[model samples]
Target: MTDEQQAVCEEVLAGPRSRLPAPLRAWLFRPELARRGQSLGAYARYGTCLAPHLSELAILVTARFWGSEYEWHAHKTEALKAGVPPAAIDAIEADAVPDLEDQQSRCVHDLVRELYASRTLSEESYRRGEAILGRDGMIDLVAIAGYYSFVAMTLNVFDIGVPEGAERPFGRGKARAEAL
Candidate 1:
């Protein structure tokens, strides 16, 4: 790796987590894009007004919806650690609606699910999201989807894989092929 590449890797490692993620490493091929992408990523995933649990849930849903295995595998643990209910994660893994107690979780799941399906938010969804999250939270929610979608695509294009022996959450299968 070039000195510049090493520098970028170090910068990412210096963040909250120590390990350099596969997606970020893949983005290293284009250092400028990676820097900007990681900056937006930090803000989108961490700077959002939504609770970590909610944001992590939304990210996992996005990963599953798009059948991005690397993304799913990356966030599943974080989502769980951030307090996303196990049942919710299980339901989303199987493409079922989770019986969540939190209104925000349900709202975020609804918003992201619809957004992935239609590439646009419906009026009812917008109103519901706005009511629950307000305008800023709603905007941040959508921004997370858009930004993570970019990240997911980068992973897919690069065929970034989980560490050896790790269980693949969104592996290629009939379900994965049909996701979409």
Candidate 2:
């Protein structure tokens, strides 16, 4: 591990949990739901419902774009089990155009690309997304992305290392993988 990563790991482990000041603990190791004021149970329920409707390729693409190893690692297995094809996973990892065969998948791909590229949806992109996802669905999609982006930032800032025996979900280079 890099020096910074090693230091972060040490700090997280060494920091007093019960005895530390509440504000300090919040700053150093902010729990995801605490930051959002939502329970983990609620978030999981929302995620589970949305995951099936979203294109797996889009989710993978977003994870890669954000350089979120935690997001990528968690969702990679989930996507596969949810029936996302191996080729699509490879395409997402390689940053290549995915050959998604369905309309829902295509719409999601477009939405993810637009969201990442512009930080706002274009007229055409918004229209397409609205049509495919409907108003509430579109809102949910954006929320999901926002939620995961927050997670990505947390994982990076806290230097949450991948679990033992877990494949490095980010690309090969250490610097590039950690940049985000």
Candidate 3:
């Protein structure tokens, strides 16, 4: 690695995460992009107005939508750690409606689902999401989805998979909807 790239990698290693994430590691070919992308991911994942669980729920939905195996494998643990129910996560992975009992989680899921399905949100979804998340939180929620979708695309395009012994979310004939 070039000195610049090594510097960027060190910066990433120094972040809250103990190691470099796959997406940021991939971005290291262009060190500037790696630095900026990691910064954006940090804010989206940790600095968002939405609660950690809500942001993680959006990320899980984005990973499922993109069929990004590495993304799903990584964030599923984070989602669980952030308090999203395992049943809800499994339902999402299976392409079924998660039995989300919390209004914020339900709102986040509905907004992301409707947007992905129709490429836009209905007025009802908008209103409900806004009511639950507030204006700033709603914006952060969308940004979280958008950012993770970018991460998912990077993982998918580069053919990144989970590390050895880690489960493949959509691999090994775990059938779900084809990637959108």
Which candidate has the top score in lDDT? 3
User: Model 1 misses residue 16 by how many Å?
Assistant: 2.8
Model 3 gets an lDDT of 0.86
User: What are the runs in model 3 whose C-alpha is more than 4 Å off?
Assistant: 172-180
Clashing pairs in 3: none
- Top candidate by TM-score: 3
Query: Which tens-of-lDDT digit does each residue in 85-104 have in candidate 2?
Result: 78888888877777888777
Give me the runs in candidate 2 sitting further than 4 Å from their true place. 1-41, 44-56, 172-180
Greater-TM-score candidate between 1 and 2 = 1
Give lDDT tens digits, candidate 1, residues 92-163: 999899888989989999999999989899899899999999999999998999998998887776666555
lDDT of 3 by residue, 66-113 (tens): 998888999999999999999999999998999999888999998998
lDDT of each: 0.83, 0.61, 0.86
Candidate number with the higher TM-score (1 or 3)? 3
Q: Evaluate candidate 3 by giving its C-alpha RMSD to the native, one decimal.
A: 4.0
Error of 3 at 75 (Å): 1.1
Prediction RMSDs, each to the true structure: 4.0, 8.3, 4.0
lDDT of model number 1: 0.83
TM-score of each: 0.91, 0.71, 0.92
